[model samples]
Target: MVDRQYTAWRLYTVLRVRSQDWGGSIVVHQGMDNDGMALAVAANLCGAVFLGLEPDPAQARVVMRAGFCDFLVNTLDEALRAMKNEVRKHRPLTVILEGDAAAHRAEMKERGVYPQLQVIREGEEPIPTGRVEELSAMLATADAAHSLLAMVVTANSNAELRGADRAIAEIIPEGDPRRAWATGAPKFFVREQPPRRYVWLDDPELEAMLAVLPAGLTIEPLSHSAY
Candidate 1:
């Protein structure tokens, strides 16, 4: 069953890559979170392979436990060396990178290692300041069913909200049944009622988001657990 799922995912990845310039070996630089692992699995399921470059042994173990083929490398340099070998072997079309993984990609680009390496940002793309008002206006028109609205707040305001976030938000608030906001990262929906908010922090979903958005952006998951 898992193998069949993997095959389907690989086909999906190929299609996605063909549609855009993004596809191939996805390297999850961040530790394996539920969302992160799901992304890795999705890529593999679709035939796209993944390499999780985690520094901490404990964290790396966690990722491995999640069914990811992970490596214990601390620095981007070390990770790059390993990743390059994988790239040569797999010859993947896209690479999914997070945190320091992106740094490695930048360095490789400078050294001319993988010139085609496209770096996807983490969170949603920035809604144009011109469009913030438009978004606000749209939100205002939302009814009880449209109460749930997905808002992407980044440390950097200039960044764009990810395509996934935008897409999720668009379909969530049509007729105003129950509000649900979707974004690349899980976020606490400010709505006060049953079915609170669905914040997807799973790696698979994030990877799906990454596959769609090839630029690094910070994605913060909204949770009641105050971290």
Candidate 2:
């Protein structure tokens, strides 16, 4: 029993603490990009339930298949209403609304979605898979700053020196962050083992996501022993 408690405590300590430190779970919903997807995966791995409020039906299907998040009200007004009710029920939550600086501010202010919600701007739409090699090189330069690295594998057949999936998978077993999407699978994985900080690596939408990442969130590279 002591060992079990120790392991649980240790895990809670090691996973990312930025969002949960505020004393609640986080909800991440970005535009038509995968940055939100990455956050959804990482947040869950860190033991925080991340709800994705994607508006596009096509994208919503992908979100469901990726096995990372929950469905929520899509529009800003509806989202705010839902969140308020959730909070009123004594549920502590930090909602991350996605959009750029201008759009994010305007949406929240114009529609009154502030306070309980944290705005994370949707990053630039990702580059077509053709740029995967270039993207890989760019990410490698910044790899030293992260702990665990994961990549988003787009279903593309572009002819490149190294395909996006191949490039990212070379470093991490799966270009995926959510492991065991199968029934009764582990919802998350530890950051160490192959450096999970790379979760945001090699995506076009990364810039926008970075642009609005809260100022205080510190990403320390986990362990590299798995490599």
User: Best candidate, TM-score-wise?
Assistant: 2
**What do the candidate models score in CA lDDT, each in turn?**
0.36, 0.36
Instruction: Note each model's CA RMSD in angstroms.
Output: 16.6, 16.6
C-alpha RMSD (angstroms) for model 1: 16.6
What are the runs in model 2 whose C-alpha is more than 4 Å off?
1-22, 25-29, 44-55, 85-105, 115-185, 188-227
In TM-score terms, candidate 2 sits at 0.37
lDDT of 1 by residue, 185-222 (tens): 22221221221222323355444544554254444443
2 Cα displacement, candidate 1 (Å): 18
